[model samples]
Target: MSDKPLHPRTRAIHHGIRRSQYGEMAEALFMTQGFAYDSAEQAEARFIKAGPDEFIYARYGNPTSRMFEDRIASLEGTEDAFATASGMAAVNGALMCFAKPGDHIVSSRALFGSCLYVLDVLARFGVEVSYVDGTDLDQWRAAIRPDTRAVFFESVSNPTLEVVDIAGVAALARAVGALVVVDNVFATPVYSRAVEQGADVVVYSTTKHIDGSGRCLGGVICGTRQFVREVAEPYLKHTGAAISPFNAWLMLNGLNTLDLRVRAQTDSALALARALQDMAGVSRVVYPGLPDHPQYDLVQRQMGAGGTMIAVDVGSKAAAFAAMDRMRVFEISNNLGDAKSIVTHPATTTHSRLTPEVREGLGITPGLLRLSVGLEHADDLIDDLRQALA
Candidate 1:
C-alpha cells in the first residue's frame, strides 16, 4: 500500500482491519477477558512490559475495541483514541483524568443535561468550575484563568444548537496552558476537523451518528497519544468504563456507512430547516445552516456546513408538542443521527429538569423542538411536517 493517507470514507472501511490467520474479510471480534501467556516466566515478562500486540486484560485493552479506537482515531485526525462504555463515560473520563481538587475548569454554559451533570459532579469534588456563554469570547476570557486546568464545551450546543468559536477558545486556552476539550457529537466526524481547528481533545457519542442506526451505546476520546494513553487510559482501565467487544464490532460496522449516512441526513436537515422556516406557526429555525442563524458565519468557517441537527421554535409548548405528535415520518425521540428522523421536545424530555429561566438562557425555549434529520426522503418528511403544522 502507498504511504499516502486515505480519504475518510475509505479509511472508515479499511483503516483498522486486523485480519487473523483465518483470512476473514470482516474484522475479527476477539471476545476475550484475559490473555494467557506461554509460561509462568513469560507471564511475568509480559506483565513487566506488554508489547504493542500483546494483551493483558480486556478492560485494559481488547482487539475489537482497539480496532474501533484506531479506526475512529484515524477518522478524527487524532494521534490516539480510547473507547468508552458510553458518551458520558468518554466525557466524564476525559475530564476526570486531569482534574484535581484544587484545579479550575472553565466551561461553556450551553450544555447537554448530562454534560452539565459531569461538571456538577466535579464541583462537589472540590474542583472549581466557571460556566460562561460559549458563543461570547468575552465570557470565556473572563472565566479562564492562569491556573485553569481545562476548558470544556460542546462545539455545537445540544437541543439549542449554539455554535462555539473553537479556534478562538483554543487560543484563549492555549494562552493559559489549559487543554481545550470539545464534545463534538453534533458536528459528526464526517465533517469534523476539530483538531485542525486547535481542540486538544475531541469527544463524541458514537451512539449518535457513528452508529447511525442507534444499535449500541459507545463513545470515543481522541487526542495526542500521550494524553490518551498516559492520562485517560490509565483512569479508564482502572475505573472500568471500557466499551464491550460486541459493541465495538457494531461500531466497526457503523463506521463503514457513517460517511454516507451523515451526508444524507445533513442534506435532509437543511431541506427541512428551509421548509420549516417560513411555516405558519413556526417562530424560528435554529439550524446553523440557515443563512439567518446567529452563527451562520461561524458555521461556515468551522464545519463548512450547518450540520445534521435542526432546532425550531414554534409559538408555544402546546404547539411544539402538537407539531411533534403530528409528525408521521419522524419518530418522537431523544436520540439523533439515527436512520429514522427524530423530533424531541427539549423542554419536556432532555432539558426538562432545568428551570424555565435556565432553559430560556440556552435558547431552549418552551416551544423549541430539536429535530435530528434522518435518511428519510426529504419531500415526504417535509409533507409530513406541512400537514402537521397546518
Candidate 2:
C-alpha cells in the first residue's frame, strides 16, 4: 500500500494517516505542547535524533500538524512540507529561509497587500529585491539575474486576477540558477501544477481553499525534504510560526472536500464571469476563462480552468459601490475563496494601501471589484449579479 501511487483526491483523503491503536476513522487531533519520554537516556537520544513519529514540542511539531504537513505535501507533489500560522508567515518563512543579507530576489509587482509587506520587510534586512510586471516575459527575463536567490509570484495574482506565466518564468529563473517559489493560493491545489512547471517551492494559505468554510487559518510550505527539514524547519520552528494542532485538524478535514468545493466554485465563477462580461454596468471582466483575457492562452496552458474568482470593473467607484450594495447573494468582504460568495472592492479594501502609481501600474482601478464565487447555484448567482447591475 505504501508503494502504490494514488490520485490527488485519494491522497487528500488518506495520505498521512498515523492511526492510534483505536483505529479511528477520522484523523486524530493531538492537542499537546510537549511529549514525554520513558527514561533520561531515551529523552536525550530523542532530543538528538527524533524518530519520524516522535515529537519534542508542539512548537517544533505535533502528530496532528505533521499529518497535515504530510498530506498537503503529498497533494502538492513535494517530498515534505511545514505548516505555518498563516499564509503570510509561510511566504515570509519560505523567502527568509532561503535568502539572507546581500542575496537578491525578483518578484512580480502585482501581489496581495500582505505579500508586498513581506518584501518590504526583506529589504530592511539587507536583501536586494526587484519587482517586474508578472505578465510580461521580457520584464521577468530582464529582472532575474544569475546571482539572484529566488523568483516569487502569485500564479494568479489577487484582486486583478492577472495570470502569471508559470513555465515561462520558471525557465528564466532556472537559467539564473534561482529558486522558483510560487504562491499557489488563487490557483487552488486542484488546478496547481506549479511544481511540475519547475517551481522549487510551493506555498499555500491553507486558510483559503484548504479550509474552505472560513473555519481556520493555516498555511503550508511544500518542497523537497531537505529544504523543508533543513532550511524551512529551523526558521519556522524557532521563529514561532507553527500552526495550531486544532487548525491543522480543520485543514485536514477541509481537504476531504476541497476538490468538490473548488470545482463547484469554479463552475459558478465561470458562469458569473460570462453573465457579467457584457453587462452594461461592467466595463471589464477579468477571468482567465474569458475569451477576451490577454492571457487566456496561458491560462489554458497552465491551469486548464478559469478558477473560482472573478474581477469586474464597473467604470467608477460609485457604480461599483452601488452594484455591490445592491447585490443580495454575495457578501461584501475582503476574504476570498470562501464557501460564502464574497465581493471585494480592491481599490478601497485589499489594495487601498498601495500607492496610486503602483495601483495604476497593476491596473487596480477604483471601479475594480473582485468576486470570489462560492458553492452557490450558478443561475441564482447570475440572477443576483444581474439584479445588482440593474
Candidate 3:
C-alpha cells in the first residue's frame, strides 16, 4: 500500500488488478456482454456518467479490458489507454479521432505497408499528408508546419528497422502545437521512453510483443486520460472496434512476462545480426543494435537495445528464397515478435502491396528478409542461419 512507484516489470504483473470477491490468484475474465443495473433509475444514471468500476456494455468497456488498459498505461507512463480489436484498429483510432478534413499530418515515409495505406485513406478524405525521411531532422523540420495537426512515425520502422528520433520529431511538433503519435511496437514497452521523450500518444500492436506466443490479436493506445476517454473512446465505441473480453484477458496475462521475453529475443537478435554480417551470402545486415547501422547512436540513446528484429539482404530474391527454404530453426511467416522465430520476405508478403518504386524507396528490396528473433538459444539460431546461408 506504499505510494512509491513500482518498476515496470512489477507494474506489468500487479498493477490495475480488479479482483472479484473470490480473490482468485489469476486475473478473472469477465466474458459477459452487458452488466445488470440495480433498477431503472440506476441504469439511466449509469448511462449519464459511469464511475471507474462501473460498466454498461462490452462495446463501451469491460473490467477485463480496463485491467489491461490500466496495466499498459502504468507501464507506458500514460494517464490511460484504450484497447482495440487489432493493431490496425489502434492505429486508425488514434489518428481518425481528431483528424478532420483539411488537417495537415506529416509522417515518415518508411512505415509498414498498412500504415501507409491508412495515410492514403486519410488523404482521400481531404486531410493533407506529407512524408519525410524519419531519421533526418531537416526533413521533419521542413515537413511539419504551423498548421500541422499531428506528426506520426514508428519509433523503429518495420521490416527495414529504421530508427526514428522520437524526441527530435516531438520537439518540432511541440513548436507548432502538433500532437506526436508514435507507433512503438518494435521498441517494446520494456524499453519504451516514448512518453518521456515527448510523444503525446504512444501505440502498440499488442498482437506482436505483448502476445508473445501469438494467441490473440490486440493493441492499445497510451495517452492522457482526456484523449483516451473523450477523443478516442467515443469514436471507437461507436465504430465497434472493442476487443473481446477473452482477448483482453489473454493480453493481461501476456503483460506478465513481456519484459523477460522481449529481452531474450532482443539479445538473440543482436547475435544473429552480427552473424549475418560475416556470412558471404549476406550482402547487407541492418539491425539498430549493430554499430554499423545508420542510426546506431540513436538506438543506444533511445531504446538502449537493438530490439528483436533483424534485416538481411541475401544478395537477390532467388538467394533469399533458397536460404529461407533451407532454414530449419526459423519459420516462414509475416508475423514478428513471436516465441517462435519468424522470417518474412517483406517485398513479397507484408509490403507486397506497395509499388516497386515505393518499396525500393523504403529499402524493402527483393533480397531483404526480416528476421524476428525468438526466445531460442542464440548460438543455435546463428548456426541455423549460417548453414542456411552456406
Candidate 4:
C-alpha cells in the first residue's frame, strides 16, 4: 500500500487489517476469549510483556476489536483508541481515569442527561464540577481553576444542538494545563477536525452512526497511545467495559459506509431544517448549518457543514406531538444518528430525569423536538412534514 494520505471513506475501509493464514477477503472475527501460545515459556513471556501484535486475553485485547479501534484512531487522527461497551462507558472511563476525589472538572451546562449524571454523581463523591454556557468563551475562562484536571463538553450539544467552540475551549484548558476531552458525536468523524483543532482526547458512541443500521451498541475513546493503552485499557479491561468481538465486527462493517451514510443524512437534515424554518406553529429551528443558528460562523469554521441533526421548537408540547405523530416517514424516538430519521421530545424523554428547573435551564422546553435526519429523500421527508403540520 502507498503511504499517501487516504480520504476518510477509503481509510474507513482499509486502515486496519489482520489477515489469517488463508488470507480471507473480509476481516476475520477472532471470537475466542483467549489466544494460544507455542510453548509454556512463550505464554510466560507473553504474560510479562506481549509483543506489539500479540494478544493474551480478550478482555485486554481482541483481533476484531483492535481492528475497529485502529480504523477509528486513524480516522480521528489519534495515536490510539480503546473500544468500550457503550458510549457512557467511554465517557465515564475518560473522566474517571484522570480524576480523583477532590479534583475539579469544568463542563458545559448543555449535556445529554446521562453525561450530566456522570458529572453530578461524581460531584457527590467529592469531585467538583462546574457547569458553564458552552457557547460563551468568557464562561469557560471563568470556570477553569488552578486544580482543574479536565474540561469536558460535546462539540455540538445534545437536543438543543448548541455548537461549542472546540478550539477556543481547548486553548483555554491548555492554558491551565487541563486535558480537553470532547464528545464529538454531533460533529461526526466525517466532519471532525477535533484533534487538529487542539482536542487532547476524543470520544464517540459508535452505536449511533457507525452502526448506521442500529445493530449494536459500542463506543470508543481516541487519544495518545499511552493514555489509551495504559490509562484507559487497564481500567476498562478490569471493569468489564470491553466491547464484544461480534459487536466490533458489526461496527467494522458499518465503518465501510460511515462517510457515505453521514453525508447523505446531513444533506437531508439541512433540507429539513430549511423547510421547517418558516412553517406554521414552528417557533425556532436549531441546525448548525442554518445561518440563523447562534453559532453559525463557528460551525462553518469548526465543522464546515451544519451536521446531520436538527432541533425545532414548536408552539407547545401539543403541537410538537401533533407534528411528530402526523409524520409518516419520521419515527418518534429518542435516538439520533441513524439511517432512519428519529424525532425526540426532550422534556418528557431523554431530559426528563433532570429536575424541572434544571431542564428549563438547559432550554429543553416542552415544545422542543430533536430530529436526527437519515438517508431518506429530502422531498419525501418534507412532504411528510407538510401533511403532518397541516
The candidate scoring highest on lDDT is: 3
lDDT at residue 146 of model 3 (Cα atoms): 98
> For each candidate, C-alpha RMSD in Å?
1.1, 1.2, 0.8, 1.1
Candidates' C-alpha lDDT: 0.91, 0.92, 0.94, 0.90
Better of 3 and 4 by lDDT: 3
Report the lDDT tens digits of candidate 2 across residue range 102-146.
999999999999999999999999999999989999999999888
In candidate 3, what residue range of length 10 has the lowest lDDT sum? 271-280
Off by over 4 Å in 1: none
Model 4 per-residue lDDT tens digits across residues 1-390 = 988888889999998888889998888989988999999999999989887689999888899999999999999999999998889999988887877888999999999999999898789888999999999999999999888899999999998988889999999999989999999988989999999999989999888988888778999999999999888888888888888999999999999999999989988889889999867778888999999899999999999999899988887889989898998899998777888888889998989999989888888888998988988898988888778877
Provide the lowest-lDDT 10-residue window in model 2. 274-283
Q: Write the per-residue lDDT of candidate 3 for residues 314-380, one digit (tens) a residue.
A: 9789999999999999999988899999999999999999999989999998999999999989998
Residue 176 CA displacement from its true place in model 4, Å: 1.5
Model 2 steric clash pairs:
none
How many clashes in each candidate? Answer: 0, 0, 0, 1
**Candidate maximizing TM-score:** 3
Cα-based TM-score, every candidate:
0.98, 0.98, 0.99, 0.98
lDDT of 1 at 125: 98
